[model samples]
Target: MAQKSFTASVNAFRDKTKAQMRDVFSEAVQDVIETAQQPKARGGRMPVDTGNLRNSLASGLNGSFGAPSAGGYIVTLSQLEIGDIAQFAWTAPYARRMELGFFGTDSLGRTYEQPGNHFVGAAAAQWPQFVAKWAARVK
Candidate 1:
């Protein structure tokens, strides 16, 4: 085959594989959100408040933050590539406080002595399994 033809074929294959990986990653992120949102009986610790925090959970390519979704995070990671980083984020203002614990006064000058649930961390602990499960589904 011509060099140009060979290169084009290889490039197409690479793109397809990358897309598949992105799909796998996206699914894995969705799994994390679902796990974190589960009820306490199911081993999840996040309490359902106004539900904003849960709805705001989103996944993006190398993004540490995202605008809170009006509905809920759709778990779309289309732009991720082989070398790109995938990030899971909660856009709510109190997300970090809830996850990591807050025992002192906040910037808003409110007092809080809440213990940490680390719900997201608990959910993310299974990241390797999630990724493996998603990857196995890729064709």
Candidate 2:
């Protein structure tokens, strides 16, 4: 029947869309990892938990659904620092308005006594652009 054929087509389209979203999330993680690498460093690469990044993005998208911030996506980067502390506590600090925390600190420590400026490199610098790109593909 035509109804059966239409159902199959819709299912195929859904599958394809899911695959595309996954690809987008993977690329976003790759972008963060690549940007985190320090060129002059000996290893020339940094170990990033990309799985976490992927999960975070998925969670963000899931969270965004039916809520005020629904359809929003997040990718976490842990290598950047401010002074003696790792700057990004949750996700792209320099770019996204997100939760932040400091390493080797306490509930009330001097590490955050004074606010400091943190920067995300050119690739991961724009939060709005990143969000918009993923939102369009997330269904």
Candidate 3:
């Protein structure tokens, strides 16, 4: 009687796939950032200037497949400044209100309308397509 044993290694395949996926994800994130940075039309009734808001926009990616336990890659888009002032002036607080027109007027007495800056919302809307493109790259 003869006994035969075979060993198959998948480490190389896994590593290569992981690297490719990372690259694809990085590129997709950059695209999202660029889209978010584009100047959005003034949707507010107050006609506020958007130059500063566009300039303050930024994006970043955190975590990786290198450490799955730490959670997968996360792409974040945000304003550069920190604290309540920044948050109210440019970040989510006032931005969301402006975009959604939740309030009639801001502290500065600027009137709002439905659908504001749409910065984050626009980027999020493109997320599905971005993921699909990244997946296609990996495939």
Candidate 4:
């Protein structure tokens, strides 16, 4: 048998995982926004774990051979102003969940700490992707 290159497979796994994660967070955020925008609703804050995604092959072999994709994006309200949350609070329940906590200041003199009711014990590796997706726009 010809030699196999597992490097490509490994990289593919990582890239796919990252992309999927980005998409998941983007969608979750969108839902939060949508929910908050609805009329006659109290916008609650986003939960630590938003919710669970349906079993799908595209997500992974999770249905039968892979792990189930965890739903929800752990986020903070640092970039969002109170008005923004209020505007979306009508539909999205989590808009009200936003909190202002203090951890420490960064080089830019910004407060960087865990917001209220965020997913705790998240893998460190997922941080960059989560933040990137949270900041990016989703159609």
**In lDDT terms, which candidate is top?**
1
lDDT of 1 by residue, 1-139 (tens): 6999999999999999988877887789778878887756666788666778777776656655455563245634545556777666777888898889989887889999998888889988999999999899899
Model 2 compared with the native: what TM-score?
0.37
State every prediction's TM-score relative to the real structure.
0.67, 0.37, 0.53, 0.30
**Each candidate's root-mean-square deviation in Å?**
3.7, 12.6, 10.2, 17.3
The lDDT for every candidate, in the order shown, is 0.76, 0.39, 0.47, 0.37
Local error of candidate 3 at residue 47 (angstroms):
9.5
**Model 3 segments more than 4 A misplaced:** 1-9, 41-50, 58-94, 108-111
Residue 104 miss distance in model 3 (angstroms): 1.2
lDDT of 3 by residue, 1-139 (tens): 1222222235666667766756665666655655655544533232246444433333223321122211112323221222212111133335555445554676789775555656556675897799788888675
Off by over 4 Å in 1: 2-9, 39-43, 56-66, 70-72, 75-88, 104-113
Which pairs in model 2 have colliding backbones? 64-70, 64-71
Q: Give the range of the ten consecutive residues with the poorest summed lDDT in model 1.
A: 70-79
What TM-score would candidate 1 get against the native?
Answer: 0.67
lDDT of 1 at 121: 92
Question: Candidate 1, after superposition: displacement of residue 76 in Å?
Answer: 4.2
- lDDT score, residue 10, model 1? 96
As for candidate 1, its clashing pairs are: none
Q: State model 2's lDDT.
A: 0.39
- Best-first order by TM-score: 1, 3, 2, 4
Candidate 3 to truth, TM = 0.53
